[model samples]
Target: MGIVRIGQTEITYDLRRSSTASERRITVTPGHVEVVALTSDDEAEIDAFLTRKRQWLFNALRELETTTAKRAVVLRFMTGSKIPYRGRMARLTVHRHGGPHIEISYRNGFLVDLPSWVGEEDQDAVVSSEIKLWLKRRVRRDVLEIASSYGRRFGLKPRSIRVADMKTGWGACGPAGSILINWTLVFAPKAVLEYVVVHELAHLSVRSHGPDFWMYMAKLMPDFARSKGWLDQNQGSMNADLFTSTRPIIDAT
Candidate 1:
């Protein structure tokens, strides 16, 4: 995989070797690009092909934004909303007067307690707030643990780890040995989250994504590309479900 910056946006694309393909072709998805070319094509040739499609890639990305926005509210704070969390899909069940306080619990699915005092108009906003906070808290703890575990293995320690909202990318390795993981990772599977943590931690050892860097990544996680591709392919839909997941009524009694 390689990254090319057309303007403000950086396109991350994977170059796949094709056996029977006659010519180079580019595929654009939400947050990923794939360059399919003959196996004999060298790195320079692939880069040239990517360069030729730069404008098209830029337009494709812009279209993805518009398309994603159109379906932004696909999932909302209503009953039966599919919640993509921790590598699994769970139905959101909202229980009115389920408890004296707003509580979030996970069994086979997510069970949220919406106190009776809250007005109907405020239900969506309130539930959305509680879940966002819950996800922030959960991501912070998980990131620390994952970073620490991998840090130990690699004999590297990050100065700090924090979960924050990001416009793009899953995690960031700060210049000061700190790591910032996007809280939205709550919507991703554990493996995907772990991959992000490992990615940032690797930055501590190697500052750039060069040969040495990927060598370390492959050593750390053999199937790193799979998780990487998953994150790229699922960039939009997962986050949509997270912020807009509609909830259900559970018997609080």
Candidate 2:
């Protein structure tokens, strides 16, 4: 990691040496900056480049600060704590009983039943795990169902539809026509979820986000713009439940 001082702001960026070309590339994320360049590139030239892009870097860092502030609220896995589910805030109710099994169910609200032996300190971990399990199950059942419906409507048959914990993108369409959607999207509004699903399915025909791709999307879902706009406006909140931490709880494991 390297630090560059631009005016009054200090930017910390990770420098990666790539073997592809002698060109430098900068990627700005919510947390930190990433600079990729060929091993032959001099550090002085890279520092000069970052200095020249000071305005853009400053704007990006400001946006990252705002996003971090919005994600400051921590998820507390206790009773009466509101959890986001299917675009609604559902109250959590944690219950302990004498059993070896832990059951999580959602009816009037969210219910987490744990074994009596589980202590208070372990309750959070247990609840977090149960919530993750419940989310994966819902993604498998509902997201796949919705994606299948849209797929049939668009006459696009993907090789497979899988769900995982994706931080950057809500969904991705692989080159081989497989779709991987983020399970966290289940907390978004139905229309937003539909938009993501349709977006990926449309990629089955059009690979790029060029004008032709959007035109095809218009043909499939006329009001896709509204859904897209909603996501753009509320994306941070939709993802806050999962992505608030500097180190997110959900992982590949």
Candidate 3:
């Protein structure tokens, strides 16, 4: 690991050599930063590349820190803890019942009932699992319907729409017309979620994010830029993975 100073912020990042990398790239996750460069590159060359992008690194680090702070409340998985659901905060209530199965339900809040035999250390994991399952069901019941309505309005029909835990992005559209949307989006406002659906559907008509694509998106959703900006600012707080170990179920390809 190496430390780089970007303005007033000091970033500690790990450097990884990738044989297939043609150019250096920087990735910022929830915790730290990563620099990926060609295996043949030396330390000095990497440092020079980082120096050139100091401003960008500094801004990203600030945004990440702000996002993490906003999400700290939901990260704790205990009774009375709050989690986001449909743009609102839902309180969690854990109950121990005499059964081998764990049951979860949601209304204004989440009710989790686990087997009495389950240890305290394991309850958090069980709660996360149950919440994920509930989110998946909501995706099937609600998000798909919303996506279809937008698709119809845009005269675009995707071959399939699947919900999964997309870590790096909100949604993706394949050449074959398959659309994969992140299930975590359930926590976002309805307008933001619609923006992502429309964005992916627009991809069906234009593969590249060129001027023509923006034109199409503007015609479909005039205020799309606002929704995109909202996602950029609040996405960190909406990350369900911060509380669980579930991976995205669909392949983007």
Whose lDDT is greatest here?
Answer: 3
Local error of candidate 3 at 245, Å?
Answer: 8.6
| Candidate ordering by TM-score (highest first) | 1, 2, 3
Estimate, for each residue in 1-253, the C-alpha lDDT of model 3 and write its tens digit: 9999866667898888889766788877545477887898898988888888787777776676676665443444568878788777889989899999988888789988888998864666778877878877886667688777876776788899888877689999987999999888888877888888889989989889999999999998999999889899988777765565322111110
Q: Which ten residues in a row are the worst by lDDT in model 1?
A: 244-253
Candidate 1 residue pairs that clash: 75-244, 76-245, 76-246, 77-246, 77-247, 78-246, 78-247, 79-247, 87-189, 94-248
- TM-score-better candidate, 1 vs 3: 1
lDDT of 3 at 3: 91
User: How many pairs of residues collide in model 3?
Assistant: 0
Q: Give the best candidate by TM-score.
A: 1
Which digits, one per residue and each the tens of the lDDT, describe model 1 over residues 1-253?
7898897878787877879877777766444467778889898987787787788777766766676566654235657866667877778899887457998998888789888898864776787778778877887888888887887777888898888888877889889999888888888888899999999988988999999999999998889999899888887766634465333211100
**TM-score, cand. 1 vs. native:** 0.65
Per-candidate TM-score against the hidden true structure: 0.65, 0.65, 0.61
Which has the better lDDT: candidate 1, or candidate 3?
A: 3
Stretches > 4 Å off in candidate 2: 1-70, 240-253
- CA shift at 19, candidate 3, in angstroms? 57
